[model samples]
Target: MTAAAPPRRTGPVRSEGVRLAILEATARQFAARGYDHLTIEGIAAEAAVGKQTIYRWWGSKSALVAECLVEGMLLPHRLAPPDTGDIRADLTAWVDAVLTLLAEPQGETLLRSIIAAAAENADIGRRIRESLAGSESIVGRLEASIGTAPNLTPGAPFEELSETLVGAIVLRALSRAPREPGDAARIVAAVLGPA
Candidate 1:
């Protein structure tokens, strides 16, 4: 039999498995070291991939971190709200979860880092908006339960209500204000009315 010539590879083969591994690794490293301390070399070692592989996919560490956040892999806690069929209770639970996260030192750092990333990059800002609107996000979860609020104030659209709650949380976190007990319930009530 005559020896056959081997086929030449045309280009880099993008592997979903490797992509996921890199994202997961980035998330782990981000959670452990925070954004300022996370290094591409460290992530590559953790994911068993080369630095070039990461560079080929993401141009910068911020871009990689943005993808991790968009994929729900980077946050310290899940951002999705509970769906208990009661909007009041659900909103309260979601708000409480967020407040609890913000109360943590690492959680505060994570939020600030995300804010800094989004502020510095338009692409990251867009990705953040996209993530918040996706089915796995808090907005999506809140939408499912919004209609069940027994005494929702008139003209209080879910968008506005959500914005109000999230805006307050962000400001509070940024300002380092102490979150008091019943804060979640009070915030929810302010937007949704007495339950």
Candidate 2:
């Protein structure tokens, strides 16, 4: 019988390094080309890794982009939505936090890229929603803290209200309109209503 060839080695350290490099490359690509035009090969080239490596780690371009967005942009701002036993204060804080992020250049670029991606690609859109909107990770914590305020039920209406508020901020950013602090505060007040 012929001797079997040695199995390829994929050490954990190297695997993690490749993952990090891919994420960095994906960020740059997304920033430069937007999500619609980004390719796995391009990311691999930018990261100095093989396309197969990216495929093995992330499975698809959408997955990679989602991970990159979450890890780089969303995770850093992961506020649990201030409870403080006051719904208005907690929501106001949350809105302020989001508005502050929207004011930053990096935040603007990332949000635009995500919106564009979501518009043009259904898979990417779903992934974006799952990463940012669907998961109770951020909003759930906020809801728990609020503990059933007057209008803010833990239901569809509340979700829609939250979406509307955040979506307005994102739309303003995309439109190149100024995001005034007062405007964000107004949105919060409108949603929560008369603390």
Candidate 3:
């Protein structure tokens, strides 16, 4: 839960290949062993890089994970909301993807670990929130979809709707509760009204 020191700017320019390998290794290790058990040494050995290499770039396990999340290397496929021209369908598909991830043991563990790390570190928390809400993020996609809909509620709160849909799943994951089969459709309806 330590803050990431600015990456050494003066060192030999970082090798993109090595950086990617480290991220891949971090994801693999995180999936195989939950975050609590993941270590820089394990990642370094897996990626065939030295521990100092990871420390030099990422500074801490939480920081490394934050980078992985931002780079879309933490999950199997990037969780993008499909733009199928039908906002309801697209939103439902997106919510389903999130639920699919949370339904898995690894995904649940990863979310829990990230939440724990963010809770213990303000910088990590800020990075994650920024990434999740950024223009290229899921919320941004939701905003785009909502903007195109013809019959949205007058003055619909875009950010709130985006957060509510995703936040519901996050809350479910954090509470260790099973999501119902109709949860996705219901959430989409709640956010967008009957479609």
Candidate 4:
């Protein structure tokens, strides 16, 4: 052969590069195949990395899935709630944002996959809760704005309300049913009431 195959092109890849590659591959696979169907081997193959690389970084398929869900689906922490000082407007806008995300095909698929994964796997469920908590800047903002109004009674737990609203949107999206814009507004009104 000519010059020993050009010296083999060796040198270890950067850890960050490998991590990003694995994450990207996992996300694409999860979006295409859902959690139940995804495999570490498949992800490794898609990423062009060794199986050990993934295992070393994420520890398990469920862990990888959890990280993928957090990295891909959830909004950034910095955005938080609108805080217009009006709970109605804030809740309405939050609901609208959630609904809009759920309406997207990728977003809907991701939500269903994560929810299903969480239901079946306790580890995944815990990770999902943690991720949701971290991603719920809006909830914290809303709670802070509400303060200790005696009549309000702290309101229905914002986390529970968020789950319900998002769950409803996911169900509607998956069922291919028409989503009524008024429905989100109504839910916000019911949960937060008039300001």
Candidate 5:
């Protein structure tokens, strides 16, 4: 008797439309039920996709949700900080862009939901952090810009300074007030010291 050939199992096909649908579904899920109640099945149904498809791409619920947060809430919407070899101008522009994004009506809600999800689930928190580990995040962007700027000593307190700048922006963003004209400049000066 002839031996039968094994069936070939190709990997899952990635579709941008399906991914967008999943992301949108995740956003709706967060809006409707919050992260505490989010479920793979629920998201699958909301996205009209099979559970295996999500698993094939993201592996776990937290990973999927983390991606949703990254794609929908935290990043991808962010603009690149201009690299003008001037830390003051670059940072001011960066913070101003963030302030504008956070000023949107749903922005606060999105930020709150992600934070709440992280607080509610330690696993989700870790996954989100891990997922973001590779991100050239705000701090990384600032460090890169600082590397090109003048007046910073080698290993100057870039991490702390970036944190200070970001923290100020986040705190101000939570207030939902119109951005003061001096806000960006003030934050920049605080970090890099005077234009």
Candidate 6:
């Protein structure tokens, strides 16, 4: 994929409204036609914005899709994780929300596309992982929220807890088992301690 160059701005830059329209259009298109059918011209037509507009904002089709997933799909989930002073409750809520999102077709489609892209492009893989895995990362957020001591332990990894959580989510997704409401609490307990 060719990296799109930003068009020279000869006038006032486009508004956020235009960028949002494009993202919405991209989501609509992705939902209607799937990821394989995404096209610059098609998105432009759907958004009623110039093709240069999109290229200026996002450098590639994958980049645009990534933004759409971030903005339209995952933004709410990202911002909604609470730090309500109770680490177990906060993590449980966050994890449950994540699981709920994954259960959606839109979330599943976006995740599957990211996985496919990551498999083909190492950069995309790393970028999406770093970007979507929480504020700095899922691990980072958990660390910030939980704040474990510098103490040492055996059989329990404090730092790499996010990887375990991610593995659990992926396994749950692939297993296609009905998720229990208490699932997140169990995960939090396993990572943190008996609640």
Q: Who wins the lDDT comparison?
A: 1
- Each candidate structure's count of clashing pairs: 0, 0, 0, 0, 0, 1
CA lDDT, every model vs. true structure: 0.78, 0.66, 0.77, 0.65, 0.68, 0.69
Which structure among the candidates has the greatest TM-score? 1
Q: What tens digits encode model 5's per-residue C-alpha lDDT throughout 1-195?
A: 999999887886699999999888876886577656778899899899999998787666656666677564435546456666666777788888878777765456555655666776677666554443333655555556645555365776655666677668767876666778878888778777665
What would you estimate as the lDDT of candidate 4?
Answer: 0.65
Model 4: pairs clashing at backbone N, Cα or C within 3 Å: none
lDDT of 4 at 192: 54
TM for candidate 6 is 0.63
**Model 2 per-residue lDDT tens digits across residues 4-32:** 99997765344677788889888787777
Clashing pairs in 3: none
Better of 4 and 6 by TM-score: 6
Badly placed stretches (over 4 Å) of model 6 are 1-24, 27-41, 47-63, 70-74, 78-80, 132-137, 146-159
TM-score of each: 0.76, 0.63, 0.75, 0.61, 0.60, 0.63
- Estimate, for each residue in 1-195, the C-alpha lDDT of model 3 and write its tens digit: 999888766776789999999999998888789777899999999999999889887757877876787677777363766766677887888888888887887677677767766776777777766776766566666566645555354466666777777788788778877777888888888777776
Local distance difference test, candidate 5: 0.68
lDDT of 6 by residue, 1-195 (tens): 998999886965779889888989887888787766779999999899889888887767777777666553535445356776566687788888878877877556656766665666676657655654555445555656544422213433544676676768777776766888699999877767675
Q: What is the C-alpha RMSD of each candidate to the true structure, in Å?
A: 7.0, 7.2, 6.1, 10.6, 7.4, 7.1
* Candidate scoring better on lDDT of 1 and 4: 1
For 1-195, candidate 1 gives per-residue lDDT tens digits of: 988999987769989999999999999998888877899999999999999999997877877887787787865355777766766787788888888888887677678767877877788877777666655455665566645665343444655566777888888889888889999999888776676
Relative to the true structure, candidate 2 reaches a TM of 0.63
Residue 166 displacement (Å), model 6? 2.1
What lDDT, from 0 to 1, does candidate 2 have?
0.66
Q: What TM-score does candidate 5 get on C-alpha atoms?
A: 0.60
Where is model 2 poorest over a 10-residue stretch in terms of lDDT?
133-142
Q: TM-score rank, highest first?
A: 1, 3, 6, 2, 4, 5
Superposing every Cα of model 2 onto the true structure, what RMSD results?
A: 7.2
